[model samples]
Target: MGRDFEAADHSAALIEQVQEAIAARTTLRIRGADTKAALGRPIEGRTLDTRAHRGIVSYDPTELVVTARAGTTLAQLEAALDAAGQMLPCEPPAYGGQATVGGMVAAGLSGARRPWAGAVRDFVLGCRVVTGHGKHLRFGGEVMKNVAGYDVSRLLAGSFGSLGLITEVSLKVLPKPRAALDTALEMPAQDMPCKLRQWRDAGLPITGACHVDGILHLRLEGGEGSIRTAQAVLGGERGDGAFWVALREATLPFFNDRRALWRISAALSAPLAPLPGQALLDWGGAQRWLKTDASVETVREIAERLDGHATCFTAGVADEPFHPLPDGLLRIHRQLKAQLDPHGIFNPGRLYAAI
Candidate 1:
């Protein structure tokens, strides 16, 4: 909930504007449409909208690189890449269907295909960002193997705009799979924790797996034969609950209800750890989506016992959902933030208090 934020479309113009604001010691909350702005704690500053700066700048299919302004929508990028038979491989879930490319990277939100395809950070080729002092800087390169400097490109992926306001980004895309098959199993609700682990350890080529309500849904993608073979090996019937998988991604009901949502990420084989309330299985058993009436601390404690952490995937109030990091890690984060934004003007207090 940034109260005094302003939206800007031009990157160069934004740099000058933010620089002036920084010189005046005005804290700013950098964003793109505020789609996922509530992801972290609420900030007390001016909100800078990076939307209106949308569109693909350069797309070199031969090099598998697509560069675009930060405000570019994932839908637009995906549709264009789909026509070209290429994709952003990271499988970023469209948060409320309004998530901009910059928002996606800032939040580092990924879908079920993450373990196989890669995380959002992995696909990031490079980025041009505006620092706290309103200085525009570029990191990484269009080429994947280029490791010239501090690897600042990937660092900004999950920084949630705390490090800087990403103005332009270039990502590596991959050719779409030859075929895709959605399949499922009607396993009992209580049996999924074991079944999912068994499937993962059995080495089935499952691209996506989740147990919602009472049905176990799986998505298989590859060559036609490979998809069919994998489906048959998993012994799943053709699915009638494909939409449930989609619901898990955008979290239709949970988002609407504004329940205290908890995203527990743990080992795929982690035992059926007790949760304080209703839970849905997603990303196989590696990720759990919980809707609970308990306090945030209660949910976090449960995750800690299971050797995992809980994050507020989406909620109304701005509060810390993650456990406090150790002093050593905090030192590094503060140092980086200081170097990038000495005045702490970019998304101040967004991720952590001092980051």
Candidate 2:
């Protein structure tokens, strides 16, 4: 649906390239639009760009299933979905660039609707991957044992291409809400969580919630009657819908400061504590974005106290931008990498140091 471009299938060439790289005993740095260049650790390998192998392979608006090549841009997919009156409810961010479908899945990021809807992996139904063995394989999507995309397709969502080359993917979609409204309330960060709980219990069609600088922003979505009822219950001024978009893209004024920004994710009920820096609560207090010069150790310590982990968003601030995995879990990661990439040819050390 993007620009009415003809469907291009470069799987043959892509597989051949993988085979050549494997035979030559070299590594591969998988890139799709390279919009998240500063996200994870840098890799050293031959670039395997997936931008040319583009187009939607199959799309049935009625079935709510879409299959597209990795090279398809997010904007393109969204535009097509928009025409069909549907959307990817996870609301993946474009990061102010031409973010590709593969890159969005690889990053496994979700927007303000994440806590209400679900994460990227939740919508992935299947994937076509080029393994390090140079074999083209398919996983999930009416497969054996894996239900609800619990197999390789879901794992690759946040794998950052460390597992293998994602050539194509199938995702489930949802229809647009019938009605929506944004509301704002001036309340302390500490009290917003309790208020959100009350709304949830009362069955208020809450979809997105974020708090910053004494303002609690809430989005109501559902039937028109529900919206009207929730509006009266909320009793606040009309809020700016652009707030969510700006926050999702990190273009908000809060992110303008030149300091290391840390994303702290804890339980939804985690107590609000005064961080050692400026903090904005999002996801109904499930995620805290902190902009501070605090040492990595100190920031992580605070996160751990809340039974959560902190990931550095700013590049070069920490060697490992991801949270360290437990020894048992880390061993599994290494084993997975070894199984999929026997020659260690795919984005080595991109996710962790050992793998």
Candidate 3:
């Protein structure tokens, strides 16, 4: 009864804050730890600090599901999972110790291990959110087989607090791999697509792959025997685990350039085109990060020709950070936003200016 009372008090407090914001017609910045404040378009609004409402709600290692409040820090969640020999398979980036699980899902930024393990959204099972009108709603479920409608939980993953405020979330977890190893080889940027294709076809245990500074780095995670075999097949030189961590968190010297950062998501089979500046290829060649002074039009044109889209991740070179959606898709997004947040009081314009 005492625990239930505390939970009720927490919910009431959050709801009251939202209701007040709605009453004043003031936009609320849905914040969790504030580590990702630099992301997305800047917003002017009263802050809704979620860190005050933090804790793990539940964890069942046998079921491979952990439910926690949105304010829970990523370190806290990862430590708990690490204790059980499990982890969030998506390998979400921890930009800092203050990074929150909500911020991870909200920003929807995946780490080096995305291609093999999955994305942050893929591991998300469900979420409890507060709509702009201050109504509490739950979508999806803790169990894997609980597919109902719309898959709204996953939709909210990359929404960046545009749709609603996520209060709690349940995620699917995986057991940590027994062993991991990194292998590196110097290679040209244009040659990476073909090499990655060959590796993918070879069916090795490559959990992470990135090409930066003429070096193709591959991470293999699995049993010791399999890693040894893979290392022999794809030999270059042994690499340290710290390399991948640096790449994931953008701490490497390659990311320190003073230029616009564009993230291009293209087909692995797409032919590599010459770009203006430094580039780092990740996700087995599907995701490429380019730091260049080139105009957004040039970058988007090249990406579009390759059957992909370019997003201006930082230093706004594009009018919109995300690629412009097709007419039909844009209509759907507006409709969904209207349905969930008719008042337009939740992180307004954080995603698209019109939304």
lDDT of model 2, residue 268: 74
Native-structure RMSD, model 3: 2.6
Candidate 2 stretches with Cα past 4 Å from truth are: 1-6, 142-150
For all predicted structures, in order, the TM-scores are: 0.90, 0.96, 0.94
**Candidate 1 segments whose C-alpha is farther than 4 A from its true place:** 1-9, 146-149, 189-203, 240-245, 248-258, 314-318
Error of 3 at 231 (Å): 1.7
Better of 1 and 3 by TM-score: 3
- What lDDT would candidate 3 get against the real structure? 0.83
Per-residue lDDT over 17-118 for candidate 1, one digit per residue giving the tens place of the 0 to 100 score: 688778898888887867765577788887787787777887878788888788887777787788789988778877555678998899888887887788
CA RMSD (A), model 1: 4.8
lDDT of 3 at 329: 88
Tell me, by TM-score, which candidate is best: 2
Q: 112 in model 2: Cα distance from truth in Å?
A: 0.8
Instruction: Return the lDDT, model 1, position 276.
Output: 73
What C-alpha RMSD separates each model from the true structure? 4.8, 1.9, 2.6
Q: For model 3, give the 10-residue run with minimal summed lDDT.
A: 1-10
Q: What is the lDDT of residue 142 in candidate 3?
A: 95
Largest lDDT belongs to which candidate?
2
